[model samples]
Target: MTLLDRLNQDMKQAMKNKDKETLSVIRMVKASIQNESIKLGKDTLSEDEDLTILSREVKQRKDSLQEFKNAGREDLVEKTENELDILAQYLPKQLSDEELTSIIQETIKEVNATSMKDMGKVMGSVMPKVKGQADGTKIKQIVEQKLR
Candidate 1:
């Protein structure tokens, strides 16, 4: 089954189980996927495209969660945390720091990026390799640490 199919099945399950929070997040995800499809003038998105969208949704929720926590908005934090948890189910397994470090090292060598000026080249090469498996912010930090 495709990711969309799985999401549809889970959405139905959430509805049947009366899980309002899960249902809300799933519906939001579906809506975003549909919006992207509409933008591209297509009804179907590739697996990679779906993964990219899912990652974007999770990142957004994580950002909101952090903001809510910092502002002492416990109510919003809890709700965002729940949404993050629901979204996490669909994201690819995250990379370990060690694994990410190694990949960055290899990418630097492959791209021959020896200075900060080469940072963009390194990032461009690394992102495609780590897209779904790693967070871009974390990868940037690691690459910065390595390049310096």
Candidate 2:
């Protein structure tokens, strides 16, 4: 099934199971996807578009979680962490360090990046491939290390 189809099925399942937290998170995801579709003037989104929205939501949650931690707000941190967990369920599995390193190496070669000056070229070429599979910060670190 398509991601949206699966989400709809899960939403129904959540309702049947009386899973309020899961239902709420699924509703939020549906709203976000609908908003994006409207913004793009499209009837529906491609899988990639959905993935992009999911990635953005997860990134926002992670940022909020860190901010809450830094501010010593345990209550907020706990809530953000729960949201993060819900967001993560929709993301692709993360790349292993070894797999990420290999892709970075290939990307550097593909972009003909010989030094740090070509960081942008490598990043531009690699990020599309990495997308939701790898963490941007981790990929940047690997790219910088390789470029340097």
Candidate 3:
């Protein structure tokens, strides 16, 4: 089933189960997807587009979690952490550190990126291959460490 279909199913289930937290996250995601579709003037989003939206949602939550922690807002931090967990359910399986490092090494070799100057080249090549599977910041850190 498509992402929208799965979201719809889960939304209904959440409503039936009276899961307010899950329901709220699902509604937010659905609205984001709908907004993207409307912005693009399409009736449906492609798999890549859906993944992009999911990744964006996950990234936003992660950033919020970090900020909340930094501000010592324990309550908001907990809520953001829960939101991240819920959003992760829709994303692809994440790449482990080993897997991500291996991919970065391969891309570095492919692009002949030997220095930080080639960071852009390495990142551009690696991001597409690992999209939605790895966090961009993690990938960048690995690339930087490997290049150094």
Candidate number of the best lDDT:
3
lDDT of each residue in 28-121, candidate 3, tens digit only: 9999999999999999999999999999999998998999999999999999999989998999999999999999999999999989999999
Full ranking by lDDT: 3, 1, 2
Give TM per candidate: 0.96, 0.94, 0.99
Candidate 1 — which residues are off by over 4 angstroms?
A: none
Candidate 1, residues 13-65, lDDT tens digits: the string is 99999999899999999999999999999989999999999999988988888
Which residue pairs of candidate 2 clash? none
- Give per-residue CA lDDT, model 2, range 28-134, as digits (tens): 88999999999999998999999998888888888888999999999999888887787787888999999999999998888788999999999999899988998
- lDDT of the candidates, in the order given: 0.92, 0.89, 0.95
Better of 1 and 2 by lDDT: 1
Off by over 4 Å in 3: none
- Candidate 2 stretches greater than 4 Å from native: none
Question: Judged by TM-score relative to the true structure, which candidate is superior, 1 or 3?
Answer: 3
Error of 1 at 59 (Å): 1.3
For candidate 3, report its TM-score.
0.99
